[model samples]
Target: AASSGDLNWSLNPTYTGCSITGAVGSQVLSCSLGTVAGNTTLPVIHVQSATTPADCGVVSNQATVATTNGTGGDSDTANVTILCPGLAIEKTADAASVTVGSTIGFTVTVSNNGAGTATGVDMSDPLPTGPGITWSIDNAHTSGPLSCVITAGTLHCTGSLDAGETQVVHITSPTQWTGSGETEVNSCLGGTDNTGVYDNTAQVSASNVTGTPNASAQEAVLCPDLHVTKVADDASVDAGSPIGFVITASNTGDAPATGAFVNDPLPTGVDWSIPEGGSTGPLTCQISAGTLTCSGTLAPGASQVVHITAPTTFADCGVYNNTATFTATDSPQTPNDSDSTSVLCAALTLSKTADAASVNAGSQIGFTVTASNAAGGSVGTARGVVINDPLPSGTGIDWSIASGPGNCSITGAVGSEVLHCTAVDLAPGASESVHVVSATGNTSCATYPNAASLTADNAPGLSANASTQVVNCVIVSPPSPPKQHHPAVLPNTGGPDGRLLGLATGLMVTGGALVLGDRRRRRRS
Candidate 1:
């Protein structure tokens, strides 16, 4: 039996067995035993171990011995020795955002607050597996290709702290993480002598055990999490104006946010901005190297904020719909803190255009009425389709009622009425084009080559796109001067080159419509 620092206990070599010892710490033990022989003293085996620590063998707080004390009249005393490990290192992450294919960073802090100087102590975090995550540490944190200057990283780390000393570690290299599962990470790490006493470097590994498990400290890690949502739930916007909204970042798990962020593809007519509190914010935002570090130092229930600016004006008039996703992640918790929300936009602006701005005096003039959006061009589709713009004077237009009109089949002057169209149930970002044909006057009237403007609405409340097409009646004129009539072929009377070009262009024109259905553009004859 022996007395160690602050505690006293006894054990007889003759005991039934070595009594189970202390808590999960280390200590020093000694014992004395011998057999009486050769007159006075007997032979004895004085066995001593350089280091006898709980972490070395008999792994747990329990210990074993060779002497199972019985009734053999063998009396002896032995001391149990315990050894304390070197120093410990810790880490904390200030994650601003976590998005797919992004790197997370952790501000690692290593401290040797206990007695005993450790030669090489390394602190690091493990890379989580899933859709888009990687493992990377800072070069400064790791000394050379395989060394960490400050007892932290995967390789040969240098001098460690004495009692009450502190150090730092920074992790980098990982980006593009999937937001589907958990992200496991690690914290304080170390090992015994690297040259002689080979000890496995300590680290935290992903426990295959699924389901929501609690967190561990001594074995540190960055548990993952994520959340996504819209600033406001609505998605409809005026065609010509803009509406404001936000994309919030949140965490709804036991682990704090590691590398967190959110990206919303602004629906048609809708536009999304950047995040705040990060190195890059305001206009355009991005997550850079170690931007979203996961250092396993967040207490449960901690959270940060990200700013999202959305405008409804870009959304074409009609119920505009879209989706916004928020992702909040912590290391180790592979894909954690995930939430998604559907967004909506209201029809804000109103307007439309005619198929043709001017119709012939006695011929049919086609007008295609349409509803368009003013803003949120990317917000997707709009729901409602309503239009009501008045038509101009002097031209016959079937839609000339509200816009100034006559009959579906009639030939008149240049006067048209107003027109109104309503298409509810229009899906978000959805649109339709309606055609209205009108007639014109006879060749004898001044309105023969009629002129009229048919105002229309693409999306009520939004801006309008208008195209003007003029139709002149077939000419009923006196023959040009003998020379001009036959051009240079008949006589010498000549016309201006511009007039000739105009005539040539008119002669080349034919009744043919060309509408290219394409995303960009194409060359067609």
Candidate 2:
């Protein structure tokens, strides 16, 4: 017999000669045999109907047998123990995949599935590390008597749960996502895959149970990164000269980047033309309204280059710093690069020419100095143009501003003086000249060399040299006059007339004495 409201038991096989009877929670068994042989055994087996946490620890069962008429009886007892309280945990996330910089939300549920209440139960979910990653627990949204807290980047919950009871905990990063498990900045993984993957696991255990079931959730992160670089063929370019620019753009993320483009505006007097191949990869380029634009799509780890051919005839002289920006669908910010090139305009030239290569001693010689601004490759005006001509050290040289379209002037005295010609501004294809006339000094059989230099505000300086030879001691013969025949013989006017003699005498006084002497000798013969 058993007490009321206790575990019940029943026999598996019914014995033909025995009978069994019992209430719901209490039962009894009886067996009878007539004239049983000595040392013969009779089977007695029983099965438990139900058990609970209250029935755990030290349980016992006893059996008694009696021979016909209760002549003899024997009893035996057996003891057994029962264990209870088991824990199980499951984890789930809101999304299976997310962008590199996005946050994720997770839910963890722990249940006590065993027959007894579980005390001192603990649940832990450790977060993965990434760029700017953070984790937090949402206590307000949690269920059950569990108190959740975060320490060392992990979320922990501890409490007690009754049989068939469950505790729900919500995990997230409050800084970026309030209801999510954690927030990640997604600093690139730095590989061709351009992806980040991690797993979050939640485990539950109780004081009575050392081992428990744990669940995990996996997530795959993805994003696209864009980068750009720009360079020029020549840093310093002349006006109207061809120049080339190279622009390189790439995507380092796992996903493809779209709507990628570059924008560049040309400076004044600068012309642009599409390159021979246009652009590399899947890019197309065009120039409109002095602005160049190139667009294309970029695959993961793909790069595109755009070459621009431009002729620059800028009217200004300074540095031209150009910047190009790269952006993509998944890029959070624009990446930009800059390349600078300098332009030099206006071309000025100077030249000096003497009227005669040789001159008599004491005779005046004339020289002309010219300064010009070339037009073909020049875009700017030559401002503050100045031409300087240094003369021989003597008082016989005289100079004056010859001709110019711009306001011009000449300063400085003769001889040891310098001829200075200045203009406020000289346009391209414009020129100015200064005439220098000098009297030959008493020193004969000598040569005088002169040099003139020019400079402009927008062009490099120039210099020119000219030389004049003065010879007064050489005897040069004169050409004979043509003979005349008038039917008969005419007067010897070609022989040597008084006028010719006077011409010879004047020539002798002017360093042409050689001609005069030759003429006189011919007349005497």
Q: Which one wins on TM-score?
A: 2
lDDT of 2: 0.67
38-77, model 1: which lDDT tens digit per residue? 3554333232223322222222222223333543344455
Query: What C-alpha lDDT, on a 0 to 100 scale, does residue 126 get in candidate 2?
Result: 79
What's the lDDT for all of these models?
A: 0.37, 0.67
Over the full model, what C-alpha lDDT does candidate 1 score relative to the true structure?
0.37
lDDT of 2 by residue, 72-130 (tens): 88889776655467788889876776654466568899988876778888887777655
lDDT of candidate 1 at residue 320, scale 0 to 100:
39
- Each candidate's clash count: 154, 7
lDDT of 2 at 493: 33
